[model samples]
Target: MIPSAMSATPQSRIEIDPAVVTAAGDFVVPEPLGFGRCLAPVVFLADYQDGQWGRGRLLPYGPLGLDPAAKVLHYAQVVFEGLKAYHVGGSRPMLFRPEMNWRRMNRSAARMMMPALPRDLFMDGLLAVTACSEPYIPRASGRSLYLRPALFATQPTLDPAPSTTFTFMVVASPSEALASGPLRVVVERTGARAVAGGTGDVKVSGNYGAALHATAVAAQSGFDQPLWLDAISHRYIEELSVMNFFAVVDGALHTPELNGTILPGVTRDSILALARLEGLRVHERLMDVDELLQMIRSGRCTEAFACGTAIIVGSIGLIGEHDGRLCPLPEPEGPHAGRLRERLLGIQEGREPDPFAWTHTVAPLDTSAPDRNG
Candidate 1:
């Protein structure tokens, strides 16, 4: 849902609604927490207009009141980022490489012709939400408080141009893995998810909207996600829905190189570094989908997996096609994906050493929640 901003609110001084504070106090963590199903009771918001950002606010989460003809509704002038706050093995919450997200979000905004948020503005929203929602953040293994910060055009107009006004929001969800088990992915040969020189590489809102149809088609084909190829030739692999693709080929890790059409996923970057650090060779090139499937069939490709902010790392049990054909990985449970996933999660959850200084600790504004271990 879109977030709304009130211009009349004070400037430079963040406003925390009394109701929001009380709501955060009374909010109860949901049972059987599904990813993004139940949102934290409060949301952090800020408005950008007249070449400046307004003071942020933390208010009760609810539906937005849009002008119905907003630019985001018609032209989709929006970008968003997905990251998590972890409260495991420590009372203070940790954010894994959030500066990367901040920078990537601004890149998407620039590509979308939107204004970039000031560093303080972006971090303030994130720190505010995480600090306020400390009591509700899930503390179990593989569970985290997923934070989503989004910016969308609020200026209502029919012209095909960037909106002068925008709304920025940060929302949180205490959640579990999006897909807990090994995934079944299908190759989408017919429909193209993104075109070269388009908004494919960025976190533009329209990129995901364009993938909805193929995702549904993949679901109907008995798969969890669609493996999209390059939009130009539809031969080379690109990425999966909101995730990056990886395969272990001939005792080495292989993934598609960034070609301006594939998303530079944070998890994918982490995996590459971790794999290299663990003495595994990694290759990023223009990998062909057909060749990958053939490698799987020939037992040369041992395993395949996808990584993203939500899934972390999900093994692909089998790769399928529109036709009734399947190419199962010889080692679907991974030998590589599993190890890489463990290492990545270890770094994320603070269970292992973070030599890279990727983990960022956010001091709680109020430690009303019980001990994280309890």
Candidate 2:
């Protein structure tokens, strides 16, 4: 069931479970590559302690031996990141804007009073896991190997201070795009997903946990996701549960500015860059939900979409309120969203030229290569 453990080299700090290649080779790709459902056969793991990071390992994908009183489980000292590895374009897998993810992960760690991840170690984990899972990576146009790198407090202590030890792991999942065509969203007026001066700007574990209740409520109300608002006045539109919000008012793209509450999305940034490069006017300012709805009613806003690592570029067909009032986007699938999604996906999947130099093609580590030790 599980591959064996591994030993690490002092310099590279990368260990390999000899059976990892076999496990990955024997694994089967899922039929309907659901989002993050099919787990790869192997995973990359590392630890942090003694004021420094330890060796990393390529281990079997299995349950972890987490302590019951772990700070992550109690005090919520945890952070995570999501990025993708495309199998198209070349023999080696391609990573889109992974360095941005690394930087953001460290920012989140800093906010949570945790340590920053070294760039080399982070890339090692990503490349190693992606290389090991190459066989199972879906080859379809919109599908990819969804890489989730998570860091958590591992020290077994119930004290109210930070944990002395931490664990980092990178797991791969062969999956399809999170959303397709258009989406139906609900305005979450009562619940605030994130607030200013909080963990809203970072991808910490507690942020998602706090949004679950409202997500459930929105799902029950027949919506795909909830559109979160500012925590204070509840009038300014912050972001969606997992994605950044955007609108096209009078032929110009408008998204809520980064107000220390919204997660700065990688895909959102890429889309903005693409839009600007294509000569589309963009406005990154405080977006009011009521004003956006009014624009939709007055036909001033003709387009709406949300972007994130999961939902690359998802069109918002309609947005509804808690009282069952609905405001449909002027166009269900607008041309702007379609055009932006095409360009973004093109660069991501290697179908088009990467003008921004945003992709990194990962060369698989040779299993047959001799170990560092002679």
Candidate 3:
């Protein structure tokens, strides 16, 4: 429901209707909340046509009437981003590295041959939605308001070209972290998440749907996710199905280098920066899966974790290969991953001093809501 306090200031290009805000107030988030399950009652929608983005507005969240032949429907010409808003023990919620998400989203849009979203629209839309949906952001330390910004081709055509018209929308879900504990991942040798000179580096919609088959297979085989290898060699570790991978090898953080196939994740970058700042050795190199398994077996690799917007940092409990081989980490929740998660969460949740200034505060629509607890 639209909160009355969500009215856009005169300086804002985006519009927030009073009626929409009023309707939003009626929504009540249900209990037993899980990640990405409970959505805010409203969303921000902007359209691009005639080679220009239109004035956007907040609307009640609902289904869209897309054409059957829309470019996004047929050709999957769409890209999206995921970020979060935290209730950082204040009346207002804080956004963690939103600018990074905005920049990455534009990168994805560029890769998909879509027009870049203006920074004003992106920031304003995120601020507007997060401000309006502030009450729904869970107060729990590990929970947050998950924000998703997506752009898709809306042009109704069968031609195999980028659509001239596009739709940009921002929707939010209030829930806990995607993964709560250590995960068991399988090594996927058959399929690749992204290929060289492909859309793997961007957050394209097809990139996720393309990996669903491997995820399904992994799940059936009792794995949480699939660790995709390099598309060419199928030996070097590229990334997990959705998150970037890391391992604590010999008291050092080792992750796969950005080899044109890995999504340069904001959390992954933050972890690296934090690790290096703490005087821990960090390496970004071509990590071979076989070698990593051997290292785990030999106790050279003490821990492994996956990082992303949704999962934050998930410890890798076990790594399974295709031929019934399982390599278990000596300590799944080792100090390295635990400390990183703690520090990252502390910064994001406003518990610790933000030395890096990664958090952005968003004023709440209604100040009456109680301050978030530590």
Worst 10 residues of 2 by lDDT: 1-10
In model 3, which runs have C-alpha deviations exceeding 4 angstroms?
A: 1-11, 365-374
What lDDT does candidate 2 reach at residue 97?
89
lDDT of 3 by residue, 1-374 (tens): 11113223322456666555665678787888888998898888999999899887777788988999999989999999999988965556888888899899999998889999998798777887888887668898889999999999999999999999999999999988998558999999989898899999999989899999999999889999999998888899999877999999998999999989999999999999999889999999999998889999899999999999898898989999768888889998767888899899988887777778788887544323232110
What is candidate 1's lDDT per residue for 129-245, written digit by digit as tens? Answer: 888888878888789999999999999889998899999999999999788547899998888878888888899988898899999989987999999998778899999988999
Instruction: Specify the highest-TM-score model's number.
Output: 2
Window of ten residues with lowest summed lDDT in model 3: 1-10
Q: Give lDDT: candidate 3, residue 64.
A: 89
Q: Of the candidates shown, which would achieve the greatest lDDT relative to the real structure?
A: 2
What is the full ranking by lDDT, best candidate first? 2, 3, 1
What's the TM-score of each model vs. the native?
A: 0.93, 0.96, 0.94
Candidate number with the higher lDDT (2 or 3)? 2
Q: After superposition, how far is residue 357 of candidate 3 from its true place, in Å?
A: 0.9
Per-residue C-alpha lDDT of model 2 across residues 259-353, encoded as one tens digit per residue? 89999999989999999999999999988899889989999999899899898999999999989999999888978999999899888888887
